[model samples]
Target: MAKPQDLPLELLQFYLTAPYPCSYLDNEEARSQVLAPNSPINSHIYSELVRHGFRRSGSFTYRPHCDQCQACVPVRVNVEEFIWRRINRRIFKKNQDLTVHHQRLVFKEEHFQLYLAYQQARHPKGDTDTDSKEQYVHFLIHSPVNSELIEFRLNNQIVMVSVIDYLDDGISSVYTFFDPTQPDRSLGQFNILWQLNLCRTLTLPWLYLGYWIKECRKMNYKIQFQPLEGLIDHQWQPLAFAQE
Candidate 1:
């Protein structure tokens, strides 16, 4: 594969992957239009691709190219204009003591255990529930560009970890998992709020939240962030939400 800059100016090389199980949708298949592998996709090149709805996982960058489905809509938060309402503010206040530590993209035994427990509780009998350390490392640790493993601690005990990718215009939320025993704390919601604050603190303009499917309740939580932009028809259209 060629580097991003070395690719043709007008047409980038992309290959369609074989049909695979759709992780988000039940009883359906999924396909991806993956950008050519073995290419150097740095932050600068990735920023351009992200604007066109591509998301990164490990070293591969891909977008949904399903034959008959377009339900996975790429959405991003306009951090500069994000409306923080009373509920969100309360969540922040509650999680004020969450000490965040940023680390390199390396695997930790504790992190892997937390991942296992999280999947066991939330996604048992799923593909990731049986993931080994090697699989975990391959899924989250290996990256070509700037990536971070953010740990959120409460009272000096690790409770959550967020894997994020820093891009030119904003930060991409790669994945996150937390101690499932503390459901009342709403750590998942708080994690996104923290990342939103990080975007503002870093003077970034957008926070890519990956794909949001209106039909999937598990994926619909992203819409809670107001004034988002969704890639529809290859155009970033401003989205409006009713007041909570």
Candidate 2:
């Protein structure tokens, strides 16, 4: 396996995207430093990129590079040190009947339908809610690295799906969508708990959770999981605010 320092210099080259509308913040523009499209991205290279605060969207690997704003902070869970609060334990117990299946990155109609429903219910009229089949396929099914699709089924019915990347050091939670109507099920929280357990079972120490924005209500749930470390100033440190 190639180490981070052993990666070819060409792979380090990046393309800065033109400022686009910020997804998390209103009326603000955002830019990304994206890896060159031609560069070969395998598991090891992507693992190195994640360690440097980058995230994968489909086959694209990029990180926030706003010219003046630095609101986006990469975060990961110290799975080995994760604390299970009362709510977390309750969520785990509630989801005990759900069966888990690990799958490859193949296109499945049922998964797409569930994703569409989730987007419409949770993010109605948002960017992904109106996605066509091709767009949905391009968004989640086109990974070039080691990725897995975890399906959560209840009574043999698909209830949720999580896309995860297997990093050299840990697992990266790419994306998760669940049956929005089942709020009581707390499938999202259960999925994270399951990933944390998986990390322990695999003896991995971290669970990369992409980026966290303090002001984004959609992201507020991330900090609730204890022992989260954020990438700040190129260093991973325990988020002081999260400690509270």
Candidate with best TM-score? 2
- Global lDDT scores for all candidate models: 0.87, 0.91
Model 1 lDDT per residue over 83-194, tens place: 8989999988998988989999988888888899898998887775348887788789988788899999888888999999999899999999999999878899899999
- How many clashes does each candidate structure show, in the order listed? 0, 0
- Candidate of highest lDDT: 2
Candidates' RMSD to native: 2.3, 2.0
lDDT of 1: 0.87
Candidate 2 C-alpha lDDT tens digits along 95-146? 9999999999888899989998998898787875447888888778999899
CA lDDT, candidate 1, residue 124: 84
What would the TM-score be for candidate 1 when compared with the true structure?
0.93
Cα lDDT for residue 95, model 2?
A: 95
